[model samples]
Target: MSFKSAFTLTSLFAVTLSVAAPARAQTTFVDRPAELRSGTCASPGEVVTSLANLVITAGDPQGQLGATPVEQSGTVVPFAISDFLAADHAVVVQQSALESTVVVACGEIGGALNPDGTLAVGMRGMSESGLSGVAYFTPIDTFQNTLVTILLVGDGGTTTVAVVDTTVAAGDTAMAGDDTTVVAETGAAPR
Candidate 1:
């Protein structure tokens, strides 16, 4: 009730609020740090602006946790085209007990995960201009050794999604889910 008491309380609240804020990172951190060997970029800012601005966890499509972006999967996590940061190519992740990483353009995943064509797997954002970058994804490997699935989003509304059987190994093209053009045959008669 007293002015002094009120001022002290307010100051305490202000101190707490200030402390709650997050601290900035001194340097950039990347899953593929070694791959980031570029003389053109030697600073944190450059690293972020060069490739993979963020990582989305399996479920957390939005970069809630810091600049190290990851795509969280399991629960239909969506990656925004703008978040791709065309200034640099973006790394996509569908992380979980099983983790996978993919590189995509700005508007690659604008809507749902519609691997609609026989070529690619992704969504659309803004106009056709959004998803105009190289599209890549990784199988749920370990922290540093995830495989990249290189494929095109293809014409029409098709996002090429394939299941790569890791057991098949990278060199072998027979691996299922390897982002290949192999189509799965479903039950029922064809016309």
Candidate 2:
């Protein structure tokens, strides 16, 4: 091709790339260990973190085109466990879906309040799935909302992960899965 043609092609490619790139800025959540410095609890202190209700449907992946996604049985708890973030220390919470069983894991916290008023934090804790490895949590602020990406290492070198977007308000009870199959089981087994 001639020099002019080559230059035009290069310019066109650059323009295409610029246009194709994501126009809106957004935060991305990742399953990686992050550094978190804890902050003092607001006022008298209370539980500030929890999980939202989620129903996992096994059959429909597309939700019948434009229709809303239907809820099904055997759903997974997106964030069944998390560490408590305090100004002094980070406390790991090993909570299972089963009300009878209890698991405990502890860790340290490093976090601070962002200038935008959102709390920025990270925590690393011992595995609550009877594994020898560690687990990590990183919270990302996207245009929609903040999400916590949890990386969990279970027994036999198995890894389980979930990106938790919804949070249960403090002092409120977290709803259980709609799946009736595992309702009689001894404990909550994450998928």
Candidate 3:
């Protein structure tokens, strides 16, 4: 019957639709596990807040993971994420000396998978215009293919010692990425 034929076509169409649709996002290496280097840290509570003067270990236009606002001596100074081999895109920050050097790395992350779309699309894309050029700041507008917005949300967390992962590596090619300009205000004990 025509009704049976119609149903068959519809089922086929549905199957085709699903097959043609784009696949889900696949993480090649979603380096979310932000663990600190045990031996390198000086003290138990001494936090590694930022990544300053980071040396990118890969990429053509090399990138560095600096620009982390860490809580240090009741002040925020640009520091590195880990003792070494950082995640390049994550940061570990301490809230209030939670545990002995108990560092935490968290932030809003999402981004463009393909060109002409979004990029480093975290919770939301930071208006590139918002970060024009005031000082040694992150290149917001010029480069659209980057993490749109990366800010530590939530109230003063329970943990005090944290590390902000810059995702940069050592011995990278392009020395264009630096932390001096990316971080804002830094913070109370971390900046």
Candidate 4:
């Protein structure tokens, strides 16, 4: 081959290899789905109020990832799981009644990621709020976006209740106390 043609071909091959190399490397980590890491928060001391806003941050309370409103029962937070587990993280729940400055509840993110890419952590309430709960981190998508579910319950003689449906067909001869309360009437069978 002519020198000019040979040089041109070599240049093209080098460029092709350079471009493909990064693409291959990118796929190495991309194949693995995002992970989930969670933490729980509670009152540092005695205080009143179960409603608050939840935030995920890099251990520091100021380094926030995202914030979402949380109810007494629970709430869902949308954040990238990989980013959450990248470093030491914390879940902070601030009381809305006190202008959200009071860190009513907080939990440090720890523990190894499960085989299914899920993690759970415990939280403590700030002050004497008598609030505590478990934070469950779950992967909702392949892109690493996690749906953080925070379930909070009072500490003082408060029982966390979950309603389950045990409805059975009439005359099916099922066990006793099989009544079910339909929270919503979607006209669809429970999956």
Candidate 5:
């Protein structure tokens, strides 16, 4: 009878410990889908290797702003994930052909993925100190077919927003959310 009681007590203790533990969030991964790297979508004009200046708003209290007509080029690839459960996975890399700027680290863009492969999040950007300034990328449309990238670059405490329309030839786009931005959709504001 003592053995049975001890065993029951042990089992109850184990159950209590397991139930009291906090739930952990799952980690999402990012991979470039082979389909996005090749095929008709990778062609010129169709590919998302460029950006166009749209709107610029100076956030500086001194009212200072500037813009250089940059003839820059880079590639923006769609993210492929092994686990769809991890919604915080952001793995978009922008490779520049110019020596003026290079993107070192790009983590999660602050958004959740939808069942249909549509990722819409607020825009967030980080720079490598004085080498460059923080730049935010916002998605203006859904990624089910194509991706529209809206970029807001911050320099000298000013903000410049550029709009780039990408023809993914059937792809999805996700934007990160910004806590500073009061936008109802992307959660990102021009910085």
Candidate 6:
């Protein structure tokens, strides 16, 4: 074959290969917004210990979703915050001192995500522990990851007021006791 013809043939073959070859796959990224949900717990002082474990569960009736350990500082769990927004979802904290069996604090996961994609709820103390606090669920990524934050406060003391004697004459009233004020002296629980 002539060198010119051979060159032309080779050039055509190369162009055909290039055209037939598949294009590189283009990566696609989805915009999954972050989400958050928070709940409050009982006063930290009411908890027997500072150490506890946080669990995310199906809360309407309080079913276990999975066991995830979380310290007072906070911990990341393998879950999407939006999935737990159902009325039946809940976050609970069990006292480590009791082998994590005693529920010292709990909060139901509910409400819509805020404009910034966050949810907040109250955590009430269990077993009359008088504990109270808030939990904040924040999405760490677009995938299944959420940062659970639990903040608990001590029991706020109670106040007692003296009773006024109503048995006195219709025109006069008398104080039967003194006023007493009590402040909670318990220390704040670690979160």
- In angstroms, what RMSD does candidate 3 have relative to the true structure? 19.1
TM-score of 6: 0.43
From the highest lDDT down, the ranking of the candidates is 6, 4, 2, 5, 1, 3
List the candidates' TM-scores in order. Answer: 0.21, 0.28, 0.24, 0.43, 0.26, 0.43
The 10-residue segment with the lowest total lDDT in model 4: 24-33
- Superposing all C-alpha atoms, what RMSD in Å does each candidate have to the true structure? 20.7, 17.6, 19.1, 23.3, 21.7, 29.5
| List of clashing residue pairs for candidate 2 | 36-110, 36-111, 37-110, 37-111, 38-110, 38-111, 39-87, 74-179
In terms of lDDT, the poorest run of 10 residues in model 5 is 32-41
Off by over 4 Å in 2: 1-45, 52-86, 89-91, 99-101, 111-129, 132-145, 155-191
lDDT of 4 by residue, 1-191 (tens): 99999999999998887665421100000000111223323223322122223321111113232222123223233355566565555666655434456555577766777788887877666656566777776776574445555655556432222222223233432222211211211222111
lDDT of 1 by residue, 69-106 (tens): 22211211122223322233332321111222222223
Give a tens-digit lDDT track for model 2, residues 5-102. Answer: 99999999988887665332111221121211233212112323333222333221242332332221221222222333323434233333442123
Which scores greater on TM-score, model 1 or model 3? 3
Residue 34 alpha-carbon offset, candidate 5, angstroms: 16
* Clash count, predicted structure 5: 8
Better of 2 and 5 by TM-score: 2
Model 1 has an lDDT value of 0.28
lDDT of each: 0.28, 0.32, 0.27, 0.44, 0.29, 0.45
Off by over 4 Å in 6: 1-71, 157-191
- By lDDT, the best candidate is 6
Q: Residue-pair clashes per candidate, as listed?
A: 37, 8, 50, 22, 8, 21
Model 4 whole-model lDDT (C-alpha atoms):
0.44
